[model samples]
Target: MQLHELEEFRLHAYENAKLYKKKTKRWHDKHIVSLTFEPGQLVLLFNLRLKLFPRKLQSKWSGLFEVVRMTQHGAMELKNKDKSSTFLVNGQRVKHYLRNDVDRELEALTLNDE
Candidate 1:
């Protein structure tokens, strides 16, 4: 009787392992997301330094710019806000900022109407 119980436990463990493997494989086969950029687009540059840059320069998380050139397949060349310098950046380093641009434009238009 004890031997039969041990065999049943082993079988249960084997079935659970097979189910876990199937679930893991399903997760591994899931698709990943992708992003792309084009020239003349504006983007925010990511600064690795937790310390902030001077206000006249790029603030740690606030630097924004235009895409002056596309470098390697997934990289880009970005011109600084003042157009003084250009930087090469990987796709992972950039984030789209169109909403900010529209907000600024609307503010400018409203001010001009005043």
Candidate 2:
């Protein structure tokens, strides 16, 4: 085509590319897996101190705890398997299993424009 027409096409493409990039970044940030847990859901707790509990509390499978509270920073308050003790754990430390109700609700929320 004409030189001026080609230049205009390039400019339009560049603007669309910039807009898409901005939208993609926002979507990535929004879905960074910041989630909460309910009162009875089971989770695996991560131990921060490796040396303290070597035999019994080996930083994994310490207890099949139930969630007590959903805290800020995506953390949760957990009750021990025996219902004797409670602790606050970070989202990074806990892995939530598949629950049909909660999982469906999460899936229904529309993804951000990207």
Q: Give the alpha-carbon lDDT of every model.
A: 0.76, 0.75
Model 2 lDDT on a 0 to 1 scale: 0.75
**Can you give the TM-score per candidate against the true fold?**
0.50, 0.45
Residue 95 C-alpha lDDT in model 2: 77
Instruction: Pick the TM-score winner.
Output: 1
Instruction: Itemize residue pairs with steric clashes in candidate 1.
Output: none
Local accuracy of candidate 2 as per-residue lDDT tens digits, 1-114? 699999999999999999999999999998887555677888777656657546763345455778888866677888887767887777687877543574443445667988
Question: What is candidate 2's TM-score against the reference?
Answer: 0.45
Q: What is the lDDT of residue 39 in candidate 2?
A: 76
Top candidate when judged by lDDT against the true structure? 1
Off by over 4 Å in 1: 1-31, 52-60, 100-114
- Regions of candidate 2 where Cα sits further than 4 Å from its true position: 1-31, 51-61, 97-114
TM-score of 1: 0.50
